[model samples]
Target: MIQASAGRDRIGRTARLGRLRVTKAGQALSEGVLVAVAVVAGVVVAVVAPAGIAVPAAHGAAAVSLLVRARTVAGRVGLRLTLSAISVAAGGLHYVLVDQMGAARHAAGVFPPVVRVLACVGIAACLGGAVAAMVMAATENGTTLIRLRRLLDGWLIAGSLFTVGWVLLLHRADRGGDGSASFLGLGRVVADILVFGLLVALRFCLPHAQRTATTVAVLALAALAAGDVLRILPSEPGAWDGIPLAAAGSLVGLFLVAVAPWLPGGVSVVGFNQRMMPVIGVVAAFVPVVFCALAIAAHTVAGGPIDTVMSALAGSVLLALGVRQGVIHADHLRITHESVVREDHYRTLVDRTSDVITIVSPDERVLYVSPAALWVYGYRPEDLVGARLPLYTHPDDRETLMQAVQILRQDAESDIRGPGRRVSCRVQGADGSWRHVESTINHHPDGLIFISRDVSERVAQQVQLEHLAFHDALTDLPNRALFADRVAHALRKRTTDEAPPVVLFMDLDGFKEVNDSAGHAAGDTVLRHAARRLRASVRAGDTVARLGGDEFAALLEWEAGAPPSSAKEVAERILTALTQPYPIGTMKAEVSASIGMAVAVPGITSDQLLHQADLAMYAAKAAGKGRIRLHHAEPPHAHRGTPNG
Candidate 1:
C-alpha cells in the first residue's frame, strides 16, 4: 500500500514540474515575438519602398501583425482598432494595384471616393478609440476632481503647443487648395494633438505597473503626431508627398500598441508617486504661456504681421491656462482643509488618553510631555520640560532606565531598525510617593519618546499572591516550603569549622483535646500562641514555621565568629514556651509540646535532616508529654521540662 501511494505522489510531482516549465517557456517565447515585431517595424520605417505602393504595403503588413498580436493578448479594444486598420489597408492596397494597372495603359487612375471615406473613418476611429481608452482608465482609477484637474492640465499644454505651431508654421501653408481637402487635413491635425494631450493625462493618473504600458502607447502617439505635423508644412511637392512618412509612423505605432498588453505584469502592480502630479501640472501650464509671451513680444518688436487668427489662438491658449490655474487652486484648498481636520483629530486623541507621553533629548533632559502627565505622574507638562529624566525616577531603578535608553539609541543607530524597548521602573509623583510605571521607549530623530503607564496596583496584587503562596494563613508564619528553602541555603553556606545548622520539629501534646472540649476556635488560638512562643524561643536569624495542623518546626543557623547556641538548649526553650497557657476569649486553655532536635552533619540533605528530626519527635512522644528528645543513633536521651513561661 505504501509503494502504491508513493508512486502516485511521484507522478503528481512530475506533472506539476512539467507544467511550470511549459509556462516559463511560453512567456519567453512571447517576449521574443514582441522584440522581433518591434525590430521589423523599425527597419521598415527606416528603409524606403517603391513610391505608390510603399505606404499601402506598409499599412497592410502592420495591420496583419497588429491583428495577430491583439488576438493573442485577448484584448477586445485592441482587436476592434486593428480590424479598422485592416479595412483601411485593404482599400489603400486595392487603389495602388488599380493605379499600377492603369499606368500600364498610359492612363490616369482616378482616386475613388469610397477609399477616401474608408481612410478618413479608419484614422478617426484609431485616434478616438485611444483617447477614449485613456479617459476611461483615468476615470476608473481616480476621483472625478482629479480627472478634471488632469484634463485641464493636458488641454493647457496641448492648446499652447497648437497655438505655437499655428503662429510659426501651418499658418503660412497654402489655403488655396480644395476646401474639403484642407478641412480634412486640419481635422486630422487637431485629432493628433488632442490624443497626445490625453496621453499626458493618462501617464499622470496610472500606477507604475500600468504606467509601463501607458508610456509605450505615449511614444506611439508621439510618432503619429510628428508625422501629421510634418505633412502640413509648406513644401514644393504636393501634400501627398508626406504619405510615406505618415504611413511609416503608423506602421511603428500599430505594432507598439499591440505589444503594450503583453508587457510584464510587475509594471502594473507597483505604487505611483502622486506627489509629483501638481509640480508637473504647474510646469506644463506655465512654461508654454511664458514662451508664447516671449515669442509674441519678439514678433511685435520685429514688425511682423499679426493676424486675427494669431490673436484668437493666443486668447484660447490664455483661456486654457486660466482654467488650469483655477483647478490647481481648488485642489490646494481641499488638501489644506483635510490636513487641518486630521491634525485636530490626532490632538484630541492625545489630550484624552491616560498614558503619559514624553519626549527627551540626547542630553537626557525632557523636551516635551503631554498633558496626560498631570494625572498620571502628578506633574504638569511645563514642570518636566527641562528636567533630567533620572531625577524623576527612583534611585534604585535609575540605572535600569538609563540602560534601556542606551539600548534604544544603539538600535536607532544600527542599520536594521529595531522595535521599541520596554522597561518597568518606579517614578516619583508630585506628592513624593513612588509609583510603579511600565514605559516603552522609542527612538526618534530628535531624541527619544517615552510612553508610560502606572502599574502600581498590579504590582501590589502580584506581591500579595507571592506572600500567600509560601506562608501559613492562621499564624502568618513561614510554611514548610519556605523553611526548607532557608535550611538548604544555610546548609550550603556552612563551613567545616563552623557550627552545623539544626532542625527542630515539635507537635502539640493537648491540641486535639482543646479542639474537642472548647471547639476548633480555641484550638486555633492555641496554635497561634504556640507559633508566637516558638518564634520568641529561637534567634531572630533562625526560621520558625508551621508544618501543618498542630505541628511546628524551626531552623537554627549560626553566624561566623559569633556566639553559637546549643540545639538542645533551643529545643528545651521551645518546649517550655509551648507549655504556657493561651488566653481564648476571657478563658484560658493550656497546651503542651513535644519537640525533637537534629543537628546537621556532613553531606546530609535537608529532607534527610527533617526525617531524622521527625523520628526524634516520635521518640519524645513515646517518652511522654512536655519532653524534648535528642536524635542520636548511639544513645536515646530525653529532657523532661515543666512550664516556665
Candidate 2:
C-alpha cells in the first residue's frame, strides 16, 4: 500500500486526509503554479523587462512539489485530475500567449519557441494524467468513477480544441486561406471530438477488457489523423508543430495503456462494473470506435456543422428512446417488486421472531434463515440462503433427524404438525467460520418452519446430566441402577442356543476391619481401589457396577460354557486382582472379595439371579473368606445345619 497521504480525494474530502509520503504527493501543483506564472509573465513581458520572463518557468518548476503534495491528499486518481486540468490550462496558455498574445521573450537560445515547447510538454503530461485518472477511477466507487470518466472525456476534448485553435491562429497569422495547417487542424479536432464521444458510448455499452483495446485503437487513429493534418502544413522557422503534436498524441495513447488497468480495475473503483459485464463489454467497444472514427473523417473533409449537429442529435434520440423503454418496462418492474416484497416480508417474520428460524422447502432448498443465524451459528442470512440446510447436519444424527422431519412433513398432510424432531447441525458463516447449531423443524401450511439454536453448551450440560444419572459421582463407576439394569438385561435374554449369562455378586471381605483399624477416609480409599480392581480385572464386554457401599456386581456374557464355570472363572479374576494391597491415602492395606455367582436359568428374572448370587456369596464367606462358590440344588452339607430365612 502507498503511504496514507499518497492517494486520491476530491476537494470536499481533501481535508479528511491525514499525512502521507512524498511519492504520492506528486500530482497537482505543477499547472496551477504555471497558471499563476503565466498571468505574471504575460503582464511582465508586455511591460519593462521582457527578458526577466524566465521567472514564470522557475515558478512553474517550484510548483511541482506543491502539486504532488496536493495529489497526496486527494490520492493518485484525484491528483492526476488536478494535473490534467493544469496541463490543459498550460496548453491554452501556449495557444493564447506564444501563438496569439506575443507573451514570451524572443532572445538568445531560448526564443519564443520555448513557450510552444512547454505547451507541447503540457499537452503530453495532461494526456498522461487523464489516462492515469481514468484507470484509478475504474477501481473506485461508481459515484467517483462516473464523474472521473466525464472529466477525462472533457480534458481530451480540450486537447483537441487547443490543437485545432492553434492551427487556425497560425493560418490567420500567415495571411493564407492556404488550405493547409488550418484545414488539417480542423479535421484532427473533429476526429478527436468523435473519439471522445465514442469513448463515452463504449464506456456505457462495452466491457472493461474491450474498453482497454478500444481506447488504444481510438487514440491511435486520433494520432494518425493529427499527423495527416499537421503534415500538410508548412512552417517558416523549423519542422512544423503539427507532426510533433501528432507524436504527442501517440505518446498520450501509450500513457493510457500504462494507466488503464489501474483506473476502474484498480483499488479505488469497487463495483464499477460487475466482473462478467467488463469481460463481455470490452469487445463491443471496437465497433463503435470504428464508426466514430469514420464519422470524424467524414466530418473533417466535409467541413460543415452537419457532423457536430448529427452527433448531438443522435445523443438526444438515444435519451428519448431510453425514456420510452423505461415506460414500457414499468409493469414488469411492478411485478418484480411485488414478488420480492411478499417473499421478503415472510422471511422477515421468521428472522425476527425465532431463536433460529429456517424455512426449508420439501425439495431441500434453504428458502430462508433467521437473524438469529448470526448469534446461533456465525452465518449471515445470505450464506445459508439457497445452500442445502441438511448439509450442515451432523452425519451420525442425519438419519434420525431426517426421519423425524419426514414424519412431521407427512403429519402436516393431515394435522400440519407431527412429533417435533431435534437435529444437531453446524452452520457456516459468510466469513467461512462454523458454529454448532440444533434445530427443531415443523411443516408449516405453506412450506416448512425450522427453529434452531446454538446448543453446543447445552449438549455438554446434557452429557453431564446423563453421567450423573447413571454413574457413581466420586468413583465414576456404574451406580446401583445401572448395575441392576445390566444384570436385568443379561437375565432377560431367552438364550435358546447358548448358555445363560453369569452374575458375580461381590462384597469386600476385610472392608469393615480396615475401616475400624484405619480412618474412615482410609476405608473410602479401599472401596475406590477395590472398584478399580474389579473394573480392570473384568473383560471389556463385562459390566462392572458399584452397588452402593462396599458391594459390587459384574455381569459376564457366556460364550460356549455353562454359566457356573464362566461365573466362577470371572469371580476368581476379581478376587486375585483385589488381593494386591491398596495404598489408602497414607497407609497400604490388603483386602479380598467374597464373591457369589449365579449361572442364570433361561427366562429367569434379574431378581432371581441376584437372590441366588447373594445366597452363594454368603456360602463362600462361610467356606473360606475369599474363594467363590456356586449355589447347590438345595444347600451345601456345611450349610444344612443353618435355618431357612
Top-lDDT candidate index: 1
Would you estimate the TM-scores of all the predictions? 0.66, 0.41
What global local distance difference test value does model 2 have?
0.55
**Which regions of candidate 1 are displaced past 4 Å?**
1-123, 140-144, 165-285, 295-317, 328-344, 359-367, 386-391, 395-421, 441-449, 481-501, 533-542, 556-577, 598-609, 630-645
Residue 2, model 1, lDDT = 37
Q: Candidate 1: TM-score?
A: 0.66
How many Å off is the CA of 426 in candidate 1? 2.4
Q: Worst ten-residue run, lDDT, model 2?
A: 3-12
Error of 1 at 567 (Å): 4.6
The Cα error of candidate 2 at residue 305, in Å, is 56
Q: Please, what are the lDDT tens digits per residue for candidate 1 over residues 1-645?
A: 634654574465456556866886897677668756774764465456543555555546655655665565444445443553454355345435433333433333554454446545655655565455445444443444666766666676667667766655555444524333434455456666766766666575555435655666667667656544554554422324544565556555545645654565312321233634646645655676677777777877889777887788788878867776676678778778978999899889888988888899878889989899999888889988999868588888887788777656654554224577788999889999989999999887778999889999999999888888899999999999998898899889999778888899999998898999999888888988888888899888889999999999999987665454577788888888888888999988878888888888777778777877887788888888689877763222333323232
Model 1 scores a C-alpha lDDT of: 0.68
Candidate 2 ranges beyond 4 A from true positions? 1-354, 378-381, 399-438, 442-446, 561-564, 633-645
How would you encode candidate 2's per-residue C-alpha lDDT over 154-190 as one tens digit per residue?
3333333333344343344344333322332343344
